[model samples]
Target: MSRERRKHVVYITKNSEYHCRDRECVAVRDRRSGEWLREHSALRGRLIGAVTAQGRLLRRMRIVVGMRLCLEGAGDEQLVMTSVVRNVGRPKKSATCAYAYQSWAGVIGA
Candidate 1:
């Protein structure tokens, strides 16, 4: 059976880390409901964000980060849906294309 997709309020920080906490600024507040982008705001240009995912897709994504997600279990667990990212960190020096692709694929069967 295909898992139903769920939208998550993900914030991909400059460190390429995932943080679901309220920025305590306009990025979180000001919105009536649901996560979205604000122009010329705290969420602008930091990184691509606010994605939706399914359970299996979420699990596979968690595997990619070696499950090194910085979230509190139980409480924050339900808040976030899923994610997949490389820790190349900052992108000043890009991970080699081969390595980057391999890194992502390496987590698939784990």
Candidate 2:
């Protein structure tokens, strides 16, 4: 029998960890069998939008590490930011910031 995929609502905590209502966040393990079930995946540069409580799209937004989001379909086919009324906290610096600085340094032969 094939198992069906279910949608999930997740949020990033202040420490930059993914939390879910279903207790299926990344790096979670089953108490019975100590097997790794999930791992981090690349989601950079993906287009996401804020959603209202009534499932309405508010506006397009970027996926930050501290935002609450809902995955609507399998393989993250649709990612919608949820709970716009709650405070998501400030986003951290982009990972590319260091890379951009290094690139500029190389160009200047510094």
Candidate 3:
């Protein structure tokens, strides 16, 4: 028996973390649609847009102290927010890498 080869692509970005909603973003896609929806039941009456995971692959990315991410929401409003990842686990075979920058510094180490 032979195994299929997996295709790999590298994504370049200065930051890794994205300020998207928990349920309304590409983080959770319903099985039925096979499409990412920009809706969240957790946030009632509040509207937000979906962040596509398709284009969000960042490899070997490091997060700085003051990195900002444009979070998309309802009315197409973009909220500039900063964040930091306190801890990261070892990358799995299916896991991807990410980069980030902040006021402190930038990291090339994923």
| Candidate No. with top lDDT | 2
Q: Which residue pairs show backbone clashes in model 2? A: none
Better of 2 and 3 by lDDT: 2
71: Cα error in model 1, Å: 3.1
Error of 2 at 22 (Å): 28
Per-residue lDDT tens digits of candidate 2, residues 78-100? Answer: 45333332333222234224323
In order, the Cα lDDT scores of the candidates are 0.28, 0.34, 0.27
Model 2 lDDT, residue 95, Cα: 20
Per-model TM values vs. the true structure: 0.19, 0.29, 0.21
In angstroms, give how far residue 104 of model 1 lies from its true place.
34
Predicted structure 3: clash tally: 10
Ranking by TM-score: 2, 3, 1
Query: Which residue segments of model 1 deviate by more than 4 Å?
Result: 1-64, 68-78, 91-110
Colliding residue pairs in candidate 3: 15-99, 15-100, 58-97, 61-98, 61-99, 62-99, 62-100, 64-102, 66-102, 66-103
